[model samples]
Structures are given as structure tokens and as C-alpha cells.
Target: MLTHPSDPRRVLVERSDLDPMALPPDLRRYEIHLRATFDWGRAYLTNPHPDLGRSGSVCPFVSASLKRERFFLAVHPGTPSDPAEAVDTMRFYRDWFLELAPRSQPSAQITTILVLFPDVPQDAVEPLVDDVQAMLKPEYVGQGLMIGEFHNGPPAKSGLWNSDFRPLRSPVPMLVVRHMVPTDYPFLRDDPEQARMYLELFGDQVPAQLRDQVERERAVGAP
Candidate 1:
């Protein structure tokens, strides 16, 4: 069901000229596919999806810096397959993203850091994903950084009325970084405190009905 980026149908980022050791085959292939894939609400390195303005593309600066994507791979030296090391790697990347993403000039801003772990195997991935989300989300939710993980874990089921079951799965293991938005409430809604935090951050822009729903849902769970 998945075809690699070398497929003639897909667009590529053209990273062939870069040093092979600095950008090896797998990472190079990732960069190529990233530009073609319709994730991140856009073809990351390709032309902007026409619907982006009406959809989830909040950071306009992202498109301008598409060719200059800011990312790091966490696979060399040793794999961070160990839970503790995974957390440490995530923390380090989080720090790097916090320091690097926002400081760029307005026109050429870096919205998120693409943290890739090209070496992690299937058995170790799910736990690492859970660890990353649990450890970082509390501190980063409203603070302008988001961490999104993609792996072979069974697709996450839909929270809304039945629609899709595995929409979040990816061909390779990936963790994306970007700012949080109002629409992310569904993903954070299960936790009352996080839901509260979401409202505090975006209540002005959230709809009255949805705001009441989030409150009512939280209040019902409160002991």
C-alpha cells in the first residue's frame, strides 16, 4: 500500500547533491517523501496545498522556509529505543526546538523541528511515542510547540462520531514539531486539566457551544 518516494508520481526535495554521510539514504528519502506527502496540512516541501488557508495552516512562515526545514535525526551512536533515552532525546530536541524555531526572522521563521528516529524498531516504538507525548505535552501545550509522533502503532481511533480509525499512521517513524491550535482540543480533551488549559489559551477564539461542551465534559468527570 505504500510506495517509496522514488516513485515517478511523487515530487522529491532533490537532496542528492548533499554529502551522503551528512544526509544518508533513508533520511534523504524521508526528505523527498516529506515534500510530496499531504501531511502537516501541506506538502511540506512542495507547493502549498491550495486549501491550506481554509484549513490548518496557521504558520504562514512555514511555507517560506520549506526548503530550509529544521530537523535532526536521533539514530546515530546508539538507538534511543530505551524508554529513558527516548525521553532524554525528546527533551534535548525540545530544548533545541525552543531555542531555534522562534528566533528566526519573521519572514523566514522556523515553526517546528522535525525530529526523526530512523533507527527505532517496531517493538520499541509505541512506548517511546507514549513517553514523548506524556512528558512534553504538559509543559508545551499552549506554549507554542507541539510534538506529533508517527509510527507503526495501530492507528488511533477517531474521537468524534465514527469516521476513520487509522488516520495517523505513517510509512516511517517520525515526530513533528509545530505550534498548537484550537482544533487540537479533541486530542487533549480526555484530560480535564489539559482541557482547561486549552480553554485558557484559546477560549476567545473557541466557539461558545464547543467551550460549553468541553467544560461540561470536564465537570462531569470531576469528583
Candidate 2:
């Protein structure tokens, strides 16, 4: 839940409109919530990589099943774009997630984060990824997971299709998800042969039980 600057429920911080940092306290707080939601989802669904902070213990990899839907989004819809905005946005989400974790089911002890980029270019996304790597470099080296789901064409375009899964080099253990599967069933969304190929390539990294689970899940209504 978030309060608005114009809303009487908030204490406004008078400042120039151009200054994103100067937004009213309530707006800023709301911005944090939006940011957190996007980050949580992006990190969990796209990149569940473990990151090491400049001062803290090593972050463990977040299990996808546990961190299914959490994230952060930009708060100010009309705010001007800023290069470092993503990082700031993620920071806010991480803090908020930590506070809200105890309240979530199964408890939010998992080390995962999500992010959403509205109006951000792929090139712009690279640097933010780098920053995240640095902030959590230790966790990313070997145990990190990076997943991405590119929508392919512009949102306005019709009849879009997700690309095949591909590997991306980003200084971390990545599980990049290039396509957005349409069906709830993995097999229906992805070609059986292709998915099998991927299983063959990375199956060794996953536990035997987990691999079996994937097979079982995909086998549902699968030819």
C-alpha cells in the first residue's frame, strides 16, 4: 500500500518537480513500494542470482518455487528517466521486501530480488545488471541464477512470439529465460525436443530430484 503526494494522508515535501529525490515523502514511499514490487518479480522470475553486499554475509541462491511472485516497479509514472534509477529502485525494494518478508507465507528468508523496467532500453539494462553483479558479486560467481523473459517485439505489436532460450554472459551463474511461455504448462509453452535439449545441457547442474520434477511437470498433457 502507498500514499500519494496530493493525498491529505501524506506529509508533502515541497520541492522542484524535476528533482525525483525531492518528491513528497508520501510519494517517495509509494515510489519505494512500486520499485520493490518490480525488483522482486524481476529478480525472482528472471534472475535469482545470489549477490554479496559490500558489508554482509554471502547471499544464498533463492529457490524459484519459493520466490515465485515478488518485485519492484518505478513509482513516478511521469518522472524523467535516469540511468541510476534502476539501482535506486532496487535498493528500495530490497529494504521493503526485508521488512515484509516475515509477513509473507513460508516467510521471506530466501535471498532473491525482482525488478521491473518501464521505458528502459536493453542497453540501459546492462549497466544495472553490472551494478547488481558488483553489489552481490560474491553470490553471483558460482551460485547465482540469471533469468530473462524478453517480450521480443514492441508491446503495441500483435502476434508476438518468445525467442528460444539462450545463454548470456554477465559474470554470474545465470538461468536466462529468453521467452515468455504462453501456457501454464512448460511443455505446451516450449517445444518438447528443445526443452529436452536444454535439460540435457544443464541437467547436471540441477539435482536429480528436481530434474525428475521438471520432467513430471512437463509431462502433463505433453505428447
Candidate 3:
């Protein structure tokens, strides 16, 4: 987690006092930027090397909005030195999602939920649909949560959670772009295309008054 030495009061995980069940420790609150990127899966933190090891990191967490940048909530079991333990840990994450999603706030729900898993196929997660539903009640605003499988190497369009694998029928747009490999800056950086795409899709969130100013500021790399 990022920390600030100059301002010790600036805490990343402050509301740890909330009911953990409804607000799990893994969930984080962030002010979502119109064109900013969120690292929910902590793909970069888990996979330091883009070439070797298991597929990218599976940040087993969920996000919601309380009117700010973006929030990330997740649990890190301290890297497991044992391979078997790692697998078990991941399996636990898959199972835990069942409990976490439902506990999430019904009103502060996001439009999209993306889950990136290991090499496992959708079939592995298909059986958990019932569990997923139980956790995510009908009131949830998102069309549905997307679950995808990921692996290491160059970026590929195929995975358990790939867009081609399980596409969303509803207008709600949520994607889990897993980095096949890791690097210093693994979280996919926002490019011009991505920026424009976000503005088009989530432009509603951008206040009309600052919309033009925001565009102008970006053009000159301000703020």
C-alpha cells in the first residue's frame, strides 16, 4: 500500500472500524478519476517479473463508490513460499468472494465487477454462480460481476474472464484486464484511447462545469 511519510494522517485503510462483514478488510475506498486506472487485483504487487511465475496477481477484492477517486479493498496473505499453499490461498479467495460480494453495500454498488483468476477455466467458477448470486442480491446496480482466468506472457484476449469468453449483455461496462506478465508498472497505464473511452462511457460522472477545464488541463498535463 502507498504511504505518505510527510502526512502520517493520510491513511490508506482508515475505516477499519466498520463492520468487517459488510465492509471486508480487503475493500479499499478511492476517489475514482475519470481516466485513472485502479489496481484491484494488485497484479503488479503480486507479479514483479513479467516473464516467469504464475499468471498475473489476482487481487481478491471488490470496489464501491462513496463519491471519490476509486477504492480498493483486499487481503494479502503475505506471499506464500509454498506452491501448494499459494494454490490453496487462491482457492480460498475464490470461495471468499461468495461472502464478500453479498456483504458489500447494496446502494453503493458499482456498475461492473471484475475478477481475475489463475489458469482455471470458467467451468471451475461456473459452479460458484449460485454462491455468487446469493452474495450479490438483486438490488446490486451492476449488470453482473465478470469472472476471468489469467496467465503469464504477452497480453492475450483469452482467459476465464476474457471479454470473448464471457461477455456482458447489459450496458454496464466492467473489465478485468489481467497482465499476462509483471513489470515495474504492471497495472496497464491509461493511453489516449483508454482516456477517451472512459470519458465517453463514464462521462456522466464528470461534472459539466469542470468537463471542459479537465480536458484543457489534461492537454497541458496539469494536475
- List model 3 lDDT by residue over 115-169, tens digit each: 2222233343333322332233221212222233222321233223343431121
Please give the distance, in angstroms, between residue 165's alpha carbon in candidate 1 and its true position after superposition.
Answer: 2.9
Locate the minimum summed-lDDT window of 10 residues in model 2: 173-182
User: Which candidate number has the best TM-score?
Assistant: 1
Cα RMSD for candidate 3? 16.9
lDDT of each: 0.54, 0.35, 0.31
Residue 218 displacement in candidate 2 (angstroms): 32
Where is model 3 poorest over a 10-residue stretch in terms of lDDT?
A: 179-188
Clashes of each: 0, 31, 22
Q: How many backbone clashes does candidate 2 have?
A: 31
